[model samples]
Target chain A: MDAMPKWADVVLIPLISLILAAILSALVILAIGESPTKALMLMIDGALGSTYGWGYTLYYATNFIFTGLAVSIAFHARMFNIGGEGQAMIGGLGVALVCLFIPWPHWSLALLGGTIAAALFGAAWAAIPAFLQAKRGSHIVITTIMFNFIAAALLNYLLIGALKPKGSMEPATGKFPEATHLPNMHEVLAPFGIEFSKAAPANISFFVAILACFAVWALIWRTKLGYEIRAFGHSESAAKYAGISPTKIIMVSMLISGGLAGMMAINNVQGEAERLVLNAVEGAGFIGIAVALMGRSHPFGVFLAAILFGFLYQGGAELALWTKIPREMIVVIQALVILFTGALDNMVRMPLERMFLAAKRRNKGAA
Target chain B: MELLTILQVLDSTMRLATPLLLACLAGLYSERAGIFDIGLEGKMLAAAFLSAAVAYTTGSAWIGLLAGIAASLGLSAIHGLASITFRGNQLISGVAINFLAAGLTVVVSQSWFGQGGRTPQLAGSARFEPITLPFAEALRDIPVLGPIYYELISGHTALVYIALLLVPVTWWVLYSTRFGLRMRAVGENPAAVDTAGVSVVGLRYAAVIICGVLCGIAGAYLATALQAGFVKDMSAGRGYIALAALIFAKWRPWYALYACLLFGFLQALALRPDVIEGVLGFKVNGQLLDVLPYILTVIILAGFVGKAIPPRAGGEPYVKER
Candidate 1:
């Protein structure tokens, strides 16, 4: 068995995977009759080509970071919270209700209220599975998956029936009031030649995502609660012996994870679309698993991974516009990333290290 | 009129329950052999697609069913390779298979049929027509039991009979046969089975493949018998419901059939107005009724019926040292 490192496995694994993923993507590009050099340049150009593109990338990355962190936090406690999609949906519902029903005097208060409502709703949604797992010894994976279905059905009903926008044929709720929309920071910055529309859906959510990352890092490294959670994750029996309640940690961890997912909905409602819409999350919760895995459950790593995915999203759209590749190819690429990441334990780390050492030796011989 | 309606409801219940019964039996075999076969949904989806595609092309229901089984077996072989050979995580592999099947079927179907999702409507000759037994016809003349007989036994497509027949065969293989003993042993503990000189991988592969075949039949039944055409995601988590039935039945084949039937009854009731009125005593939202089967699944899983004891080493891959 490999020994645990003193620093952090999270720091090393993701960096290695990213580099390996880049190399693999290069090969894929080559096989598809695309020049790797031009593809790289195009991707960079598309992602950062214009200010609007950069804004859009950041806007997308904001949601990815929130949901990715939500998954990563649960992963740290050795729990697979597959219900992130459900939680995010509940959050979106909360935001929609607040935006539609609650009368807010200002946008900031509306945004805060909507976000908090989302978090609370998401936590409540997740709490059911956590309770079942903790109290009844029901497996979390199976229960969460079931809950995901229930949530989807419930959302569908709500969107089409009670929450349906007036006079709209689409199965979606009404748009939020202008007062409830997240203030366009991009608009404010545009006069300074900041180029905001190119930013897609950019808002203050990016700062919140960064702050959330730091908070996650501090919670994991600097607090007693984090220690107990980590201990329980490592070994339930050992954690119990150390006077920590494994059940409590599991429940709390799930709630926190789910709450974060709810917060991600704010990015959609307040930041991006400025209204609750059908299929708003759009598999971001599932893709969050890939992000969390690629990040190795670290907050900072999740932040970086989310940005990489954002780049992929933006570049993929650009590729579709400029080249023959379908936009769905990005989904294929994302799936491949998850497949590689899941199997990373078996394939990525040691082999790459060995190859790197071999290259160093060849260089030394030449010298 | 009320009695006639009840009989019609009963008849529909059995028809609806048939696919779940077949899929549950499929889940039972693989899970009993210690493989967590959550890919039942994917297998069923693939089989449904393949069966519909073939039946639509060849104008033969039998050939369509066979094609479905073949497709399921091929997909299950991939699952076997990943979980049994590569020792990959069963849950992850299952999830991956579901994603791959969902996307691949849609992609291919779009390429072939040129429709958004659906294939061409199957012809009458390419669909499973209701089987009418002489006894059931004669019995239907009787008052209550006649309707019950007609509803429960007669008028179902051929797959329902196949599913009901499978229960006895499953019981026999699980209890009396040497392969059944080996499968049970492997599920409980592969190391012990290996120590007893049985090939764990071979046994697991067989169980999973059998599961695939059953799921294929179930899928074909859904397409040809249940609806006479394929719809995207028509399986619609029925596979998961089958899995829940497997657990609720304590992994017993006979008990699993009943569990599946109960869920099937719920599904049929959800769709049938008379049964819903009789049971709930009032009209309910169709959407709420649609959620009843899943809610029941969760409740059963939460120990509403009894405790669920899974195979000891169900999700773990088996490795042997020489």
Candidate 2:
């Protein structure tokens, strides 16, 4: 069978699936006694209408970008690294320790230290599962998921036992020193006279997320290591015969993935909260899977998908605030998107493929 | 003092283990039939919510249990349709189901009852009441065995007994029945089973439906028997823990029982701070204990415990041409 045209395959199918998801979401809203068109308008207005909205949207987009790249890297190695939630938690710990203990004279230096520490800690947490999968044939999915819960419990222990402020009842660390606070989007954009929201959490870390996407693209598509990782993912036995070591590919790819996941903490923890808190990751790791899948694991595609989700999140918040719709409806919308895009993907693709095939046949007959 | 402490721990273990055991057995059926169901949590959550809502409305726990089973079966059918019928990725479908359940439970609950995604508190006949065995008063005078029989074994909701009975029933069906053999065969090698003239899809659907039934009971047990009503995200991570237990058991029924009990014991220990305080002579962090099942599952999967080989055809959808 002939493959579908690249343009149609890459662009058309996802577009159709997304439309289907949106239609279903709209129907669900109608069932709940709300107007779907109005909901969409509210979402757009709240997410993209103002600098304030963009600030929040971009801040969320930054988190998604880090996690999407993380998931994409592991997908390239044929590994499902579901431990991102846990990995990011540990990464926050690393960021907290660096910002708390190190007396950096400048915010930039603190950012550098925290980024390195977060990546290292995330990598370390991921290493155990990677090694087990490489050496012992443990299923990466099961092990990584287990690690997520373990990470949560481990973080809980640290916060309650050692990390909590001397007399604070809350299970969170004391605020970081002011020197470690990253520049918000307003401050960063003001030098260029681009007015932005002062209160929005979008910060310098957003740039870092964009940079990470480029690095991942270069690593996955351009480098020799990238070739080996893709080769292993495509066919491990064939790649083994071609001299790619499964152990090396799996371990390296997962380490990079874990590092990317950990870096997400820099955006949320150091960049926004300026402190380590419980549930800081807030299901962003799980959301990454959908982002990576929707993006087709491409860097540029991931960027677009992340922004779309950012819109949904900010807009969903608006819908909850203004309409009688509960905040959980956002999850339903997101889930429908995932259902159509990731799971029932073929429902859109097979028909599109058939249509493309018939068009080619018609052209042949006419010629 | 020691005996009483032991009894208390054991009692809590029994209560906690019931849900885990039911869910683990549910996963076992699906996985054994070659469908990887990570959606057990979702199914349980749906069941828990629907059952509570129905029970509260109708004032009958029995009808609620039926409603929960029907809701769970509906979800199981969706999973089967996506993974088996549409030939989509099983893991992705499972994740979607989980997300759907989590979101839908809250949305529907709010529409129906309007208590921030919670059902009204179940009371009277709407809840599962503890059942005391005959001669409980007479048995109380006896020492260790008496407490074990009357306290630990008896005097719990009927769902606990049903879950315990399912262990042996699951074993008998899987080993002694033709359907069980065919189900196992379908999981290990669907092509071989197809070649033998048995319908692979039929067996898988059956396994999935049974899995849904078990998950429904587990959910009903949680909402009605244990907690008295449904709360949002009430299943917590128990489904994943049950999956881990299924892995630790290496997909066997009896071993699944043991694995669930062990996990439940860990959970009970974590919940009861006094237990650790009593044993260690000081506070031992419950968080560590809270994470013990997950940590142990990772270790077990890593081959520190033993070798665990999943069904060869577990995640693959059988395509005849391929």
Among these predicted structures, which one has the highest TM-score?
2
lDDT tens digits, residue span A148-262, model 2: 9999988888888799999899999999999999999999999999999998899999999999989999998899999999999999999999999999999999999999999
Best by DockQ: 2
lDDT of 2 by residue, B157-188 (tens): 99999999999999999999999999999999
For the record, the alpha-carbon RMSD of candidate 1 to the native fold, in angstroms, is 4.3
Tens digit of lDDT per residue, candidate 1, span B85-191? 76766776676566556655654565568576678898787999989876987787788788777776677788889998999999999999999999999999899
| Runs with alpha carbons beyond 4 Å of true place in candidate 1 | A1-56, A164-171, A188-192, A311-335, A343-367, B134-151, B278-281, B319-322
Model 2: per-residue Cα lDDT at residue B208: 91
Global Cα RMSD, each model? 4.3, 1.4
What's the TM for chain B in candidate 1? 0.94
Chain A alone, TM-score per model: 0.89, 0.98
